[model samples]
Target chain A: GENVGLHLPTLSVQEGDNSIINCAYSNSASDYFIWYKQESGKGPQFIIDIRSNMDKRQGQRVTVLLNKTVKHLSLQIAATQPGDSAVYFCAEKSGAQKLVFGQGTRLTINP
Target chain B: EAGVTQFPSHSVIEKGQTVTLRCDPISGHDNLYWYRRVMGKEIKFLLHFVKESKQDESGMPNNRFLAERTGGTYSTLKVQPAELEDSGVYFCASSRSGQLGQPQHFGDGTRLSIL
Candidate 1:
């Protein structure tokens, strides 16, 4: 079965350090990918997105790198802050309108 | 502009009871989606609606769950004879268009507890 999965369940980082969360997707037909941040008791918030046609995309303090050959996706956060602590999910646009999400990586930033 | 809004932020129901979750998507957003996160599990897509029609419902767990989006403004998800395993947080999201790669704005979600 096709699914999206995370490389790690949790990631701990010190404040001002960089954080990278990795994901692996099995479906090669997926063309669009997105990263979302969800705090405890809240819905997932959109962070950044990348299309399979491109290898990389950048946002404020965040970057998403996609590798089609290995079907790997990564989200990089620069200068991790306390507020950046949350569960980060990587989702792929499956089929027409549905998005399949990865297991997610709990990002913990220590001050 | 208001984001997606869900009613009854939390719902508690006994097994075999019925519960309906409501979602009011962002105004003029023609695309709406329903998703769920079970305990200790990642969020999963349930279904999607493009206006008043169902776009895709492949993710719906079973026939016990019924979703309707009349008038294409607000949508409702009804679970009949809910089971203990039905306990989870239901989230609603909306996007300006149903086009591929469009970002979906989400609501806080309705927590449903079936005891």
Candidate 2:
């Protein structure tokens, strides 16, 4: 079965430094990708998304880079903060409304 | 505006007991989706509803689980005679429509524990 997977299960970064998370997808037909953040005892919150037509998209302090050729996607967060500590998940749209999610990466900020 | 809201943040039941989860999507959003995450696994899609009609239910594990969205407003998922493997977190989400590339907003999810 085609799936999306993360490079690492956990990541720790120093406060004020940048952080990057990587994901690889097996399905080439996927056209849309999204990043979500989930805090403890909460739902997955929308972070940012990128369309397959574009290689990169930027948000306030986050950026999503998509490599269609390699079927890889990465999320970069600038200036990591304490509030950034959470589980980050990358998901790809498989069909019309179905999203295939990767195993989440737990990001911890070392203050 | 209020985001997606789910009832009973947590549930604990016996293996043979039944459980029902509810989700109230954002007002006017006609697209509803159900997903679940079991222990140590990624979130998996269960089904999707467009308005009051089921658009796709390929992900549904078995007939023991049933979902309904009456009047296309709120939806409920019922799992009868639950099993130990049924314990997990169930999440409901909604988007503006069936349009491609629309982001789906999620709810906090209901954590179900079957003993």
Candidate 3:
């Protein structure tokens, strides 16, 4: 069986601390990268997005860093709260093609 | 503007039963799309509809999944004879257009459990 897909590594952080979730994308041609958050029994909510032209972008309490050099992207959450605990996914889109997503990283915040 | 909306937050049905999920995108948005996330898997694109026509449905898993957007408004996805592997969350989203960077607003999703 051929393995190695778009799965991401899980990240765990304590409440009030910072958390960083990383993802490695497959397609270098992907022009835009987005970060989404999904809580239990809920859908993925838009967090922030950055293009291949930029290295970083930020929102209220979260920031997305794109390292095109290594095809690596990451989301940094500041002062992580339990409410922010959820499954975080990184999605890549090229042109008008369908958006492709990583396997998702479980962000567990210990309270 | 109102966000994308989906019907029946959750649905549980026996295998081989049929189920339908509905979605209403933000008003005036011309591009609507459907995505699905299976258990322990990444979210996969199902199809795209521009107005009342299906622009792209390359990701549709099989023929059992039927999608329609009548009158270029709300849309529906019908899954016939649902299988155990069909249990998962289905999401609907809409974008201003199919540009490279346009963001797609998503619905909360419908959780389907095939027993």
Candidate 4:
């Protein structure tokens, strides 16, 4: 089955440094991609999203880069903070309202 | 505005016991979705409802799992004769529309532990 997968299961970064998470998807028909953050004891929260038509999209301190040619997506966070510690997942819209999610990457911040 | 809200943050039941999970989506949001994460696996979609109508249910694991959205306001997922594999975190999400770019707001989720 076509799926979305992450490059790393866990990542540790120093505070104030930048962090990057990578995701690879197999379904080329997916037209929309999103990034979500999940803290302990909570559900996945929306972080940012990018449309297939565009290759890059930016939010407050986050940027989502989409490479349609390679079917790869990356989320870059500027100036990692303590609150940034969580599991980050990349999801692609498979159908009208169905989202296919990756295994997720646990991001830990070093203070 | 209040985001998606789910009832009974956690549930513990035996293998044969039945469990019903409820979700109250944001007001006026007609699109509702159900998803679950089992152990180490990624979140998987279960079903989707559009204004009390099931738009898609291809992700439903089996007939043992039933979902209903009455009046297109709140929805419930019922698992009867649950099995050990039914244990996981069930999350409910809602969006104002089914548009391509609309982001779905999620609830905290209900953790079900099947013994």
**Per model, how many backbone clashes are there?**
0, 0, 0, 0
Q: How would you encode candidate 2's per-residue C-alpha lDDT over A1-111 as one tens digit per residue? A: 111232438999999999999999879999899999998889999999998999999999999999999999999999999999988999999566899998878899999
Worst 10 residues of 3 chain B by lDDT: B96-105
| Span of ten consecutive residues with least summed lDDT in model 4 chain B | B36-45
Off by over 4 Å in 1: A1-8
lDDT of 4 at A33: 95
Candidate 4 docking quality: incorrect, acceptable, medium or high: medium
The fraction of correct interface contacts reproduced by each prediction comes to 0.63, 0.67, 0.54, 0.69
Model 4 agreement with the true structure over B7-65: per-residue lDDT tens digits: 98999999999999999999999999999988767899999999999999999999899
* Docking quality class, candidate 3: acceptable
Model 3: lDDT of residue A40: 69
List iRMS for all predictions: 5.1, 4.8, 5.0, 4.8
lDDT of 1 by residue, A22-99 (tens): 999879999889999988778889999888889999999999999999999999999999999988889999567888
List TM-score per model, in order. 0.94, 0.96, 0.91, 0.95
Candidate 4 regions with alpha-carbon error over 4 angstroms:
A1-8
lDDT by residue (A1-111, candidate 4, tens digit) is 111233448999999999999999979999999999998889899999998999999999999999999999999999999999999999999667988998888899999
Q: What lDDT does the true structure give each of the candidates? A: 0.90, 0.91, 0.88, 0.92
